[model samples]
Target: MTADRAAAPAVTAGRAPAGEDFGVYLVTDTELAERHGHGVLGVARAAVAAGVRIVQVRDKTASARDLLALTAAVAEAVGDRALVVVDDRLDVVLAARHAGHRVAGVHLGQSDVPAGVARAVLGPDAHVGLTANTTRHLVEVAAMPSGTVDLLGVGVVHPTSTKPDHPPALGVAGFARIAATTPVPCVGIGGVELADVGPLRDAGAAGIAVVSGICAAPDPGAAAAAFVAAWDGAGR
Candidate 1:
């Protein structure tokens, strides 16, 4: 039973769990800073202004202290309007919690903390999510311990410079196939642009996760709004 539970589905529904809708995933990088002249918090503020339902902060390079500070700033900016998610750092997640951020969740990649461990450490209320870019990983997500994660970042939907080593971009057909198999809210990440959000949503993405699409746009708020509009129109 223990072994079986360890592999139960993270999200049972094929789509986003209720109320989990279109979102903007933020990844902090030098390009984002250079282009926007602000860090993750600035992007989150813009996204929220543009009606983003959720925000995931993914900073692969920030130190734990830097991430914690950023997370606090992000939480303050988002306030009660948007769900704030920290990227692959459990310690940061804990720090956010300790700081009374009421943060919504944490998103982990394949090599980050184990989902079960994360669930246990994050407690039962905090939302947990994972990245899965392949059909095999989708199947694995479907079999993850139930309630271990609340959503999935499933992509590299198109070839991206962000994760250049990520397996081939899962084009429309591949997106559909993976979506069909994933029993979770699958958010399309990697190379998503405002123009692509609608189609990606149509391909069964619960939301679109972006880096450059929003952060690097001339006006991050407007770019995020466009994605929100596109997702709404896509009917996904």
Candidate 2:
């Protein structure tokens, strides 16, 4: 279907596996990963090994082919240990999956391709996330068929250069207010840090997506582990 035509879920309403953990999401930036003598794939592997539940491939500078290669390589490297999603690139997701990679799906923006079209294109088995902070954006997702969007990345929890264009920061209380209005799972993103994990989770965030907190770290694995530990111990 065209990106603009009215779209519907390709199948029934779906949710991620009950066992899936949205507690710690790692969004990779090749440049940040490279800052400490690491590559995106290498960082991704390290994070996943540390119990990171989701890894999203999001390198703004990478060409289509390069992104596809990295996504596939990450999927291969991550194996079934965690889910790998392409940030705002449904094309690379399709290509990587076409090449027999296990890309879970994509995370798109309000300005990127419409979430509905992406939902139709990728089907229900795929996990689709749309960046949303405003209640209006959450409403947009609520209007779609049950499975049209499986996840929502909802914040700029703090200011971060990784996504200079991020929406106004949605601190824990704000995020919780948004989370309260929707049943769909939401992961807080933007400049989230290790210390933000437990509070975000406690505030009702299904997870907190990290960029510099892990990618630019001297040790991404340890960084990821700390985040995971914080999430696991939240509210205890």
Candidate 3:
């Protein structure tokens, strides 16, 4: 079910409608879930119930077939509860959506397929999130056509083992600097945690994307709820 062979559907079946919050984004890690004894599906089900507005299915190690299956499972479990996006893989997003599973979009790194091309391919209704950490990168996104990107993930908010090669850590101030330069909603990602939510929200971040924070939590739902609580409290 590669992108090239998948039917060019309008992604109508399971795509989540717009207007959902991006706050408290959850990026899953299969190994982390395994270590925590709550498989990816379990964590996704619980986390969304606790207000994780966006769920990104990011299993770097999974095969294309496996990833597509994972996306379908997550989407089915989430239903209309949250947007389910594939991390760094446009093809799987397409394959899953083609199969009638509700997959919202894909999150791509700067080096992945250009966001503009992705936009052209997925059409206006799809939700796309791009990883851009610098002022220059964000400026590039700003210049693109409207709806080319729905969200911008900027970070490495604090050093963590998740992405060892992650660019220099972008503290709230650094993240704020980059975030201020982009018009699209900026989601602070990388090593984000529960405590970082308010400061990030205060720093102009629209949301915070976490991996291990929720995946490896003693209780995934509680951890997600805490992050949502912090973000909500910050606005008061």
Candidate 2 lDDT, tens digit per residue, 1-236?
11111231121112346432476889998887887898898899999888777788998888999999889888888846677889998899889888888788899989899988988888867889899889789878889887787778888888889888777787888888988898888888878877788888787887778889999999999999898888878735
Instruction: State the C-alpha lDDT per candidate.
Output: 0.71, 0.81, 0.81
lDDT of 3 by residue, 24-140 (tens): 788999999989999999999999888777789998889999998889999999846677899999999889878888788899998899999887888877878899888789779
C-alpha lDDT of candidate 1 relative to the true structure: 0.71
- Sorted by TM-score (best first), the order is 3, 2, 1
lDDT string for model 1 (136-232, tens) is 6776776777777787888788888767679888877777788777667778887877677667767777677877877787887888778767776
Clashing pairs in 1: 7-143, 8-143, 8-144
Write down the TM-score of every candidate.
Answer: 0.86, 0.90, 0.91
Candidate with maximal lDDT:
3
Say which prediction, candidate 1 or candidate 2, comes out ahead on lDDT: 2
Error at 106, model 1, angstroms: 0.9
What's the candidate order when arranged by decreasing lDDT?
3, 2, 1
